[model samples]
Target: MFVRNGTSTLKKVLTCPPTFLDEAAPINEISKKYQDQPLDKAKLLDEYQQLLDAYAEAGVQVEQLTPQESMTNSVFARDFGGCVKEGYILGSFKEPLRYAEHAAYEEKMAELGIPKILEVKKGLFEGGDFAFLRENIIAVGIIERTNMEGFNELKAGLEPLGYQVYPVPADSRYLHLDMCFNLVDDNLAVAYEEGLPTEFKELLNKLEIEIIKVPEEAIFQHGCNLESLGQHRVLSLKQNKDVNNALREHGMEVIELDITETLKAGGGPHCMTFPLHRV
Candidate 1:
């Protein structure tokens, strides 16, 4: 059952792999990189398994997704998209070549019994486009990966269930809401204000949300890719020293994963874990 109350209750979750064309087999019009300098198959497999292990160790349930033969090119597959209390909202890739990405997710969600399903077909929506700040409010970015239609679709699907969808206009530096945003807890978050619209900042202030600024270097390094493991706990793929310190000062545990090879293709811990339940 979905937890009605606390972040501490989010102990169970799900994650996908770095099934990008380079990490897995080349599918669709996936880059030539997979066919060119391939990542060591064994190492890639190990990395996926290690991610599984990390979740398992944290007491997070794991449901591994197998890649579709046609959507390997889509980066959405790499991060697994933003998930809500009901279940994972799988992305329908906006990129034409990545359009086939959604077809296979239904079967996986069925296997896991995730009740709700949201698909943005006409509008481009990647997983990185949304951020959950609190149970009622979420921040979504209008970027190349996430569009106005997709954002609207997400709100239509979620708001009826009592979730409030907030929009944050983004620039190129952060292609997705997640690139410069994430909720550490009910009251805390990190953001790159340069990309966050004034309207969104005003909304955050109205809600009494605390904004922790990520340094220019950290934002550039994708520091906003932080994922919450539990209350005051976090997991980051790259070890940005500044981000780590900021998190620590805020009383959050920052665990860094070795993702140099995995992230090169695009994505981090938040993209990997599609949390289905909060225990």
Candidate 2:
């Protein structure tokens, strides 16, 4: 039984190694907006290993995903799908380069005996735009990676399952909601206020969730993206010092790793992982 509530402590996670093709893919095609420097193969592999180690040190079981030789962006495994109470929801990709990534995931999910609750093939709907603010409340960002059709499909699938889907307009600058806002603790979150819509903030207020605003410039550094190890523990990028310090002040234990090479690919800890079970 795979289950995840997004904000809870992570117990098991799915990840993929930074394969040769992943780092060899055309950098321009992968992240045109960021125009990141070409990744160093050796450095990228080391950084990915450290990410897996962080989960191990936190007592979270790690399941390595099958790498796709023809795909470059498959290393960002979180975008492939999301784990729900019953099983998994296969996510659709907005970037043409990543469209084929989900096929590998389908095979893997089936091998693991996980059922597909929904397969969003109508339009683009990357998993990075989805998060659970509460068990019954799910927030989905209608961004470049996830469109209205995808949002509607998500709502249609989830609403019948007793979830209230809240749509947050995208800022365009941030590819996903996770880049601007992340649920840290039970009722606390780190957010890039400028990147989020006013209605999104108002919704958080209505839920009485505490929000810590990260500096605008830090959004590119993925300050709002981190992985929870449950019990207020987090896996964060050491380069995101300001946000790490802030999380520490809030009484969360932060395990930091330097992922400069990984960051060049435009993903942090949260983007690199797909949680299968959370406590």
Sequence-dependent TM-score of model 1: 0.84
Every model's TM-score = 0.84, 0.94
Alpha-carbon lDDT, every model = 0.65, 0.80
Q: 1-279, model 1: which lDDT tens digit per residue?
A: 553322445566655554554553332122223445666545655667777777777777776666655665433343335566666666656555555656666667778777655666566677777766666677778865777887888889888888888877766545567767777667778777666788888888887878788765565466777777776777776466777788788888777777655544455666566566664
Clashes of each: 3, 1
**Whole-model alpha-carbon lDDT for candidate 2:** 0.80
TM-score: which candidate is best? 2
Report the lDDT tens digits of candidate 2 across residue range 187-272.
88898877788888899999998888887767678888887777988888888888888888999898998987777677889989
Listing every candidate in turn, what is its Cα RMSD in Å to the true structure after a full C-alpha superposition? 3.8, 2.0
- Indicate the residue-level lDDT of 257 in model 1: 73
